[model samples]
Target: MNPNDLVQFLKKDPKDFTKDDIIRFCEENKIEMVNFRYVAADGRLKTLNFVLSSKEYLDTILSDGERVDGSSLFPFIEAGSSDLYVIPRYSTAFMDPFAEVPTLDILCSFYDNTGKPLASSPEYILRQAAIAFKRETGMDYKCLGELEYYVISDVDEIYPGVDQKGYHESAPYCKFAEMRTQALLMVARAGGKIKYGHSEVGCFTKDGKYYEQHEIEFLPCDPILAVEQLIIAKWVLRMLGSQYGVEVSFAPKITVGKAGSGMHFHMLAEKNGRNVMVKDGKLSDTAKKMIAGILDIGDAITAFGNPIPTSYLRLVPHQEAPTYICWGDRNRSVVVRVPLGWTGSTDMAIEANFGLKRRVEKASKQTFEYRVADGAADVYETVASLIIGAMHGLSMPNALEMADKLYASGNIFDKEYASFLKKLRQLPTSCSESADVLLKNRKLFEKDGIFPPGVIDAQAKKLKAFKDAGLSDKLLGNEKEFAKLVQKYIHIG
Candidate 1:
């Protein structure tokens, strides 16, 4: 069922939405548990469980959401003051096909003691930006994230299959063929629209041994719903991986010297049901502004989009994870790509319960993809921050003209592109540099107070401290430093 069904079930408050109808729906699906899922500031998904069989218990908990000790959360929550409330949105409800207990899961947002929405909360921050985007532009934005990851069995840890190249390899050659099918099923059941998934061109290496790498991609949809699907998809993969005797890794660079995974975002804008990004059979002025916005603060936003040190590892040249600031049409090597729609391709509409496919518009209109981030980035923060940057750039005079000059200057993949973009502008080189960029462009985050100054300060301080501590060089010692770093922050939602 769609979220509208659950929303219609609640006659009282919208968020207090689990009612008899929802109970009946749960019973029909044999759901034994209801899970409330939220992300900490570091983007890790945390869960709070409640029994779904009893309506009274559901009412009690929904009326007064369970309190969380915020001290244990990521940097967004202050250390000394530690009380926050999590309230799940019924609109986020979905059935998990991989859950052993047959659970119902809903993504949640945070609230303060006085019941006000927590501005620092990533979900809340994204929600505020989305609302502002709709109000200011009189247009809606839809985005889909194509997330990539690696898989290996715990029993056979650190084995990076032979030759270290495995992009688009099918069964007999690919061990993940069966597992990928199951992953797509679970993703569809959990309300994800899967465009496609395949093995990526990456090899694993550890202790002087070589192995394999893989990637699964999805079509673009609503930003918030798309992010929620990302969280669920990762959960499904991990849970099922355990059952299948494999471990999943979403780290930017799982192997030290191979191709790194990137979480690319394909975005489009529309107003009155017509795409506003396209005008006169070309990218419109508004589209240029959006691209300008992305390129303008691309490095500053990397403080959130590519949050970790290893994240920078993946941003190097020729790995498919972009390093330079320039954007190119159909160029995967660049930071941003204006993709040409594939010929003879049909627009697909994947159903929530199965792979229900349909045809929609033709693939003539171009879609924008930001390839800087990986699975490690916080969905809410990255999208929200990007939106903030887009709006900020939209306010600039001759923004479209500026964007034209920025990307049309030189071939970004050339030897001189680094200096070329630097002469124009380029992405920050490190966490310290990224933080410095953010501090200089602080107004983008502070507009409308959607992202509180405290949150920006906290992120900046943490990045600065990470730099000062030399953690990039000192996170862990020995050949296992890569694995250690991945394990520390790779599970982020």
Candidate 2:
């Protein structure tokens, strides 16, 4: 099914819908249970479910939310801290297709007893960041996250090394075709608008190996909805895979020396529903400003984008993963790539300027894709940091000019990787390095107290502990240890 056609099923923004609307829908559909999901400090999904039996119970939850132990989720609340409230965001409600019974999964937020947004809540932080940006610029942004993962029957059944080839290979070569279709179809039914799902470039090459790479690219939506869709899609895939006796992994390095999955985000900024990233067939001032801000904080943002030790294994220089701190027009080697038909502006402008009409078919208006993040990172925190960086750039006078220089710098990841290091910095090679950067630059995120005052402190502490333990050393050097670790954490089984 065309993804655009699935838009009609999407739930309206929570702020736009009334409590009565959701209650009415639940009554009409007879959704027997409600699964409330929220993001932990580490960005993993946690759930508190309820068996719905009456409108009164539903109404109470819709208004007051359910209370849960906050201390259980790391870095969220202390052991003695008062229990936090898990308020369901009605807009995120979608049917759980894999559940034994008809159930609704609604993404939720953490709040204190007085109904204040919890400082430790990633979702709330993401929302505050977006609202802060909109308040300052009077413009809103929409985003989409492209997710890639490996589908295999067992964790050990992975395709490794240069011999494996699976990018868009048809049928027998892409043995997981049926799984891909059902996963994408499940995403759509769960209210996500995925543009397309296809076999990816990395897979297990061994004849008997049952491993394949798959990608699901979503259409642009607001920050809250976009992140929700990613989490929902992942949750659904995990559940569906279990029924089929398959293993699904979004781990950065499922296997050493091969392509790792990435969760690239696409974004578009608009003011009064008009594209603000492009104007009159040129890169709008807003677009340049945002890009400049992103570049300015590119390396440090990795704490949330590529936070784990395994992530570094995938982001090395030679692989498809981006390591250089630069952006290029459709140059995947760079950290950021403005693809050929990005936002349609460049494609259309080229035709009008050079009479290349035939190539304008996919021309878009004004959209930007941030390719630095990987699937293993925390989505809410990562996107929030991205928004903060972009908005911060808008405040700088030379942001646009600086962006031009970086974009014109060519592929910094070219043959002379060593030479480019003298000018452009490489992405942080470890969780510790990136955490240190965040600690030093804490003020950037704390501006106007938009993010909680101690967010940086808390995050730094977490990363520091992970680093001091020497987890990265063990994961990278010992294959036996790495396989065991991947089986336990990465497989999501």
Best by lDDT: 2
TM-score (C-alpha, index-matched) for candidate 2: 0.87
lDDT for position 95 in model 2? 72
TM-score of 1: 0.85
Q: How large is the C-alpha RMSD of every model relative to the true structure?
A: 5.3, 4.3
Which sections of candidate 2 miss by over 4 Å? 1-16, 154-163, 205-209, 342-363, 408-410, 415-421, 468-478, 481-488
Prediction-by-prediction clash tally: 5, 6
lDDT of 1 by residue, 85-165 (tens): 888776567665656787877777888888988878888888888888888888787788887877754323333345556
RMSD of 2: 4.3
Question: Which pairs clash in model 1?
Answer: 160-210, 160-211, 160-212, 161-211, 161-212
Q: Per-residue lDDT of 1-493 in model 2, one digit per residue for the tens?
A: 4232112433454445567777777787778998888877655678788899799998988898888888887564678876888887766666777778878777788888688888667788888888988998888978889999988754343233234578877675566778778888877876687788888888764335456788989887789878978887887778778878877888887776767888898776788876777766666788878988988888888878887767777777667778777776766767666664454334445677796466434434557778878887789888888888888889999997788767734555556545645777677777788888887777888875666767777777766776634465656668787666655558531
Q: Each model's TM-score?
A: 0.85, 0.87
